[model samples]
Target: MSLNSLRERLIERLTPAGAWTPDGLPDRSDYDLNPDAPRSPRTLRPAAVLVPVIARPEGASVLLTRRSDTLASHTGQIAFPGGRLDPGETAVQAALREAREEVALDPASVEVLGVGDGYETVTGFLVTPVIGWLAEPPVVSPSPDEVAEVFEAPWDFLMDPANHRRDFLEPESGPRRWFWAMPWRERYIWGATASILRALHARLYGDEARPGAAVGEDAA
Candidate 1:
């Protein structure tokens, strides 16, 4: 598809911005691959992330960040720019605010298209992936404290099902845990980050392609 067509199709497929509802769609979770894992009913904190798809002449790319090693948790992990909501901020508001705080991405530069599926994390937070569009390559300055590095992954690579792998790890104290992992070059994209991308892939192209269908120039 041409760049314009790709952008339009994304907006058409995504849940409209500001129209998010927890009950509106099914939620993906860390336990998706672990069917035997016991799940308890509990309150989940609200969170949001900015899934920025940058428009480049060559192709689309997604904006991501590597969390700073100095952080208390999830150190050196790749993630979207976002965090828990503050006060009465909406998901879209928090997403934009967090992006600015984490990577110096100007909210004005982003044209939010819509949100993807809601994801419940093992850490007890319900995260909404807010999709944003950047018409040009963004100039980002990663925060030294919250973010270690900022990078972009090709949208085609991320949306390809062949790259999505179901991997598992055995812990000393629990049942074997399984999660989605998409390894790209030197970066190991997994956990909640990978899961969110996997969900987005399904949302955009789940019905359009047959199982094992190859990702091509137009399919991307």
Candidate 2:
């Protein structure tokens, strides 16, 4: 689909975001965040991330970030620029703000499309994926304290079911965890980030393609 078409479709699927919706691309009912399944999830902390799709002439690409290794959580992992919602802030507000802070992504330069379903993470975060379209690539500088690197993944590659892989990991704290993993070149994308992307893929392609993997969260 063209960039404009994609934008319009997203707005139709996810406008008036933040609230859980069963009518759109990101259907969340399939995900079961097992509370008694272990880990340290006490509550679902509200978080948001900007899924930036850059409109290139050839096609589109999704912007991704590698978190700084020094950070306490999810260090050195690939992720969309986003974080916990500040008080009184909506998901869109937090997504835009976090994007700006982490990658110098100008909110004025982006066209907000809509948001996907809210994903419940094992780390106690309820993350809303905000979709935004960039007509062209923007000047991006990673924050020294937050982002270690910035890159893009081809939209076509990401939305292909052939690349998606289901993997199992036995965490020390619980039973074997069956999660998705999408490896791109030297980078490994897995866990909650992959799950969220898979959800979006399922919504957009209707089971035709699946999210192969993603960069975010930890194995534990």
Candidate 3:
């Protein structure tokens, strides 16, 4: 689908309350924050991330960040621009604010299409993925303390179902862990970020392709 068409469909799917978390998407319902779970959280919060799409001269790409190692959680990980939701702030507002703070992305330049279902992380966060279309590319500069490097991956690469992989890790007799993988360039996209992307891909393109192996090489 064209960028415009995709944006419209996402908006239609997300505008209604609880639309994103409709009875589809198995993972949406299975998430639990029980401390007994292997990856139980010390604390959990509601958060949002902006899945910012830019119409680059090369093609359409989604902006991402390699987080600094100093962060307490998910350090050195590839992540979307987002964080915990503040008091009185809506999920969309938190996403835009976090994007601007992390990457200098101007909120005014983005047109929010809609939000995907909330992806609950083992780290104790209910993360809402906000899909947005950038009307024009803005100057992007990573915040040194919070972001190590800012990069963009082709939207087509992420949306393609053939690139989605499901991996399991047995954590010391704990629950069998499941996560999605999407390899692009030198980066191995996985974990909660990849899971959400996988859901979006499945929503946009039905699950016809078989799961593959993790993108083994480090894209760094």
lDDT of 3 by residue, 106-198 (tens): 898998877776777766677888888886777898999999999988777887667877766787966776677798879988888887887
lDDT string for model 1 (1-220, tens) is 5467667767888989768854343378887888789889888888999999998888888999999999999999989999998978888999999999999999999999999889988888999999999998988999899999999998878888889999988899989999999899888889999999999888777787553342345234
Name the top lDDT candidate.
1
Candidate 2 regions exceeding 4 Å error are 18-36, 39-42, 207-220
TM-score, predicted candidate 3 vs. hidden true structure: 0.79
Compared with the true structure, the alpha-carbon lDDT of candidate 3 equals: 0.73
Candidate with more favorable, higher TM-score: 1 or 3: 1
- Badly placed stretches (over 4 Å) of model 1 are 22-26, 210-215, 218-220
Between prediction 1 and prediction 2, the one with superior TM-score is 1
Clashes of 1: 1
Tens-digit per-residue lDDT, 1-220, candidate 2: 4555555545765655646332223235224533246555255678889999888776678899999999999899889999998988888889999999999999999888778767776666778898888988989999999999999887766766676787777778756667677888988777777777777776665633322332110000
**What overall lDDT, based on C-alpha atoms, would model 2 receive against the true structure?**
0.74
Model 3 regions lying over 4 Å from their true place: 16-44, 170-176, 207-220
lDDT order of candidates, best first? 1, 2, 3
Residues forming the 10-long window of minimal summed lDDT in candidate 1: 211-220
Q: Which ten residues in a row have the lowest lDDT in candidate 2?
A: 211-220
